[model samples]
Target: MLRTTLVAAMLLATTPAFAQPEPARVEVNGMHMYYEVSGEGPPLIVLHGAYMNIETMGAIIPALAESHTVYALELQGHGRTTDIDRPITYQNLADDVAGFMEAVGIGKASVFGYSMGANAGLQMVIRHPEKVDRAVLASVAYDAKGWQPEFLAFLPQLAPEFFVGTPVEDEYRRLAANPEGFPALVDKLIALEHEPLAWEADVAKIETPILIVQGDADTPSPEHAVAMLRLLGGGTMGDMGAPLPASRLAILPGTSHTALMNQPELLKALIGPFLRGETPKGMFD
Candidate 1:
């Protein structure tokens, strides 16, 4: 998937404005997984947030593709991937991601996920460490308590109509393999959100370099974001002559979880180099 710089540019030239690379399907975990492959260089699997699909990451992919082979997957029940009768959980989705990577013959790659996708990204590192070299978790927390009470309280009250005027509803209607399944997907997610999260120990055990990004005013307060980072070896002063921690944290100013995709440039600045095996400019330093 490593392409010369000129080749990367050519791919862009051929891609129309606001369109992603054409998607390909694979069988993973008994589901027909849909993924879009683009860009050139090391592989980077980009996971979209719950209730969204590849298009959610559309604004960010073109730039990211300039330097990496981007594998954007639509998880089970989201986008073109069909849902099963099983309960929706990050652990199951993480397994599907692992199977998808294997199906596509990608042995190892950096993974990035936002919001619910962020939850999955962290799980990928914990559940399938061999397949991920680094991970980026944005707008999420590893524990249920990591979320603000207001946000937690509002989960069960969400209805599909609540997103009617937004792109979330529009896209779900547009790209979901089973358009009618959107409502079901929403309910499942609401239920999942209320369940206790158990990622602190898993995250603490992850040795893969990670970048934790969040919007200052987004889900889980900045304080909780820092707490998660601490568990992942970030947000701490280093001992004299000690090795620098592999994890980094960033809190985007004036950002919201729902608004993350719009600020592609800032996200690219914070994460681009880190995926390339380079130290990202420390946002917290």
Candidate 2:
């Protein structure tokens, strides 16, 4: 059961409610990155998880597009973007996103990132704070220890062949500029999984308002999520009269990493108000 669930979580694919619009290309960090923009309002950058593209973000794109101009990106070798020689790391991906925004004329925007994208968004918040307003980080872990032990144990066994008949492979073959490089991409991502990822110290220094969204059964353990909230100055007793923390945490019941992406309605409800800076008024308030 753990292996099966981990496989699905690694793929992170979801059926799109609608076909993606034509993507535009921009020269970013020595690669021609692909991105699509939709709807209108405040600028919001939406990033996909590992082995995922803009289409795999599922209904969340449309859900967010209704309230914000959604800039859905294909990072590095994923989706329509071709492989570059540099290793796939959170820092590199974050740098590419920052450069992409600069090349495309967006000065600053809110970011909503999931899984691998979430890690990159954390880097952006830490390494390039001036370019982000607010951020929504979904299914992320600050360090290797934050991952559930079972999930961490399963990472070493990952191989491209395991995904051959899955939607992940199908989409890669359909959209990757260099389709035959899928195996190489998987290898790079595998190395990425093994890379050191301790960022709790950096996270403690972040000043940008962020929402940490996790599934009850996510790869990052629930306790780790709460620890992250504390690092972000969250986990406060709001009704006790103290000021609310700049960050917030949401754990969806009965959801896994993959399942979390499918909960577009719930995500929209949490994300819209966060980005708009709308605080809900309660009777106690």
C-alpha positional error of residue 176 in candidate 1 after TM-score superposition, expressed in Å: 2.5
* Per-residue accuracy of model 2 over 79-113 as CA lDDT, tens digit each: 98878998999999999999999999999999999
For model 1, the stretches where C-alpha displacement exceeds 4 angstroms are: 1-20, 159-169, 280-285
Tens digits of per-residue lDDT, candidate 1, 71-125, equal 9899888889888877778888889899998888999999988777888888888
Give candidate 2's error at residue 110 in angstroms.
Answer: 0.2
TM-scores of all candidate predictions against the true structure: 0.86, 0.93
Q: Candidate 2's error at 181, in angstroms?
A: 0.9
lDDT comparing candidate 1 with the true structure = 0.75
The global Cα lDDT (0 to 1) of model 2 is 0.85
Clashes of 2: 0
| Candidate maximizing TM-score | 2
Candidate 2 lDDT trough over 10 residues, lowest sum: 1-10
Model 1, position 62: C-alpha lDDT score: 77
